[model samples]
Target: MGTREEIAFDRALGALIGGALGDAMGMPTQLLSPAEIKADYGFVDCFIDPAPEHPVSKGLKAGAVTDDTEQTLLMASVLLQSGDSFDHHAWVNALVAWEKDIKARGGYDLLGPSTKRAIDAINAGTPPEEAGRSGETNGAAMRIAPVGILVPPGEALIARVAESCRATHNTTLAISSAAAVASVISHGIDGADWREAIGFAVAAARAGEKQGHWVPGGTIAARIEWALDMVEGCSIEEGIARVFDRLGTAVISQESVPAAFAVLKLAKGDAWEAAVIAANLGGDTDTIGAIAGSMAGACAGYDRLPQDRIGGLVGIDLDDVRELARALVRARLTDEKARHG
Candidate 1:
């Protein structure tokens, strides 16, 4: 590969691996309150298995990733196969298959509420597009990295994001949140600076809000803007406290999406710190950490992540994920060339 292409390839790999690292690291603390997290594991600096008392993650080993990485891989595989002609049926099928696989393994970490409800609807004869018309969770946004990587940012791209979300999360806020995350990944892949990437995300989200069917709630765009603004001049601890207390870190897209962005901004593009900070946050830590790690990984590239942390990932091979990232970058380049040439 040429130098520029090689760099892109590395960053893509970094983004995926970094996401996994964050997911695994935060698994033990996923549903804990911030005070509970502090009381139990302290700062959560390393990967630890689910504590016996842990409500959700018990029986899972340290370094094992949860639904976040699994769903992200589902989307990545679909993107690799279909490229710009991505098949919605294929995407939904992959998710359904993944949900089954996770359950068969006796893992309590199954699909999120929106995804579960939508998939049930699809299984019960509802059309895929109508399955999740009211889903407002971060389910779609959490797994949207692949979509952002493969598609250029624009109205069409955001529409495609919303369409993909339709399989599970189709509300205006959900779609906008997913579009924002995807746009950040897209812009970051194309080498936009951290601030520039945030700008792209905010703009794409504003436009995306108008594309999806409306649902009653606060605007994701405004929430994202407010979250970013909240962290501007604060200390890292103070910024995190603000996000934890105010911006929120729950499964709701309105909260998690903006919180993820705010944490990433606070980390200033450092993949490790971003993941660590998100991991320590109360509520939905794994997803928030994964999101931050994904964005930071895209900005900093794979080579920048520490070797020890990469070595600690459970049930995942770094080389395999690196190969997946390479394939994804190649597919994206091919898709871009065909459109712009």
Candidate 2:
């Protein structure tokens, strides 16, 4: 690999590993308010199994990651096979295969309601496109960081991958949410300035909104606008507090996506702080943490993450995620060269 290829490979690996580590670390205390988490565990730094007293905590002891990581791995596998192109059929097949695996595992499935519905529709012979026109869940956005890493920057590229997200999450809001997150990842991989990355993300979100997916009553755009406004006016803590106050514990795409972006902005280039703050925001903690972690990981890279903290995850191998990221970086580079050379 060339020097540029090596750097991109390393950055992508850092992002994938950092994302998983952050996901596992926050799994136990997901969705708890800052005060609630403080009162319970006094600061969640490692992968401690959940206790009986804590429902979300109890699930953690089982070493189970919610739909966030599972879908991410699934999406990565699909993208790897597609060779940096958008193949709708392969995407559907991979999701179907994942659903089968989930069924075989037999306990506490990670497939969300919307994803399940889409899978069922596909099983019933519905086209992949129409199968995913369900509610606007954050499931689509949660697993899309890899898409950002693999694809280049362009609305067309973003839209193509965003449509792949629609194979399960078809709502305009959900599609837009996925694009917004992917755009951030693309810019991060390209090493754009943080402010420029944020601007790109905001533009992507607005474009999605323009497609009529952003409903009238939805507060997602408003909240995102508010977050952007607070960029210069508030401390990270204050900004987090504001997001939590304005957008509560609901896990819908409208609530969670904006909140995740808010926390990402607040973290200000610090992955650990960004993740922890997102985790302590009180509801949908894992998803929020995962999303924020993706952004932070992309910006800070894996080398910047603390060693002691990275050592704490339980079930999954962070090394494998890094390997996948490296492979993906190579694939992205090869494709880029083929197209432009």
Tens digit of lDDT per residue, candidate 1, span 100-148? 7878988774788888888889889998888888788988888888777
lDDT of 2 by residue, 21-99 (tens): 6576567777577788778777665566655666544645533465577678778877887753566778777777777
lDDT of 1 at 131: 85
TM-score to true structure, per model: 0.95, 0.88
* Candidate of highest lDDT: 1
TM-score of 2: 0.88
Pairs in clash, predicted candidate 1: 63-314
lDDT of 1 at 151: 70
Give candidate 1 misplaced runs (Cα > 4 Å): none
Q: For candidate 2, give the lDDT of residue 17.
A: 57
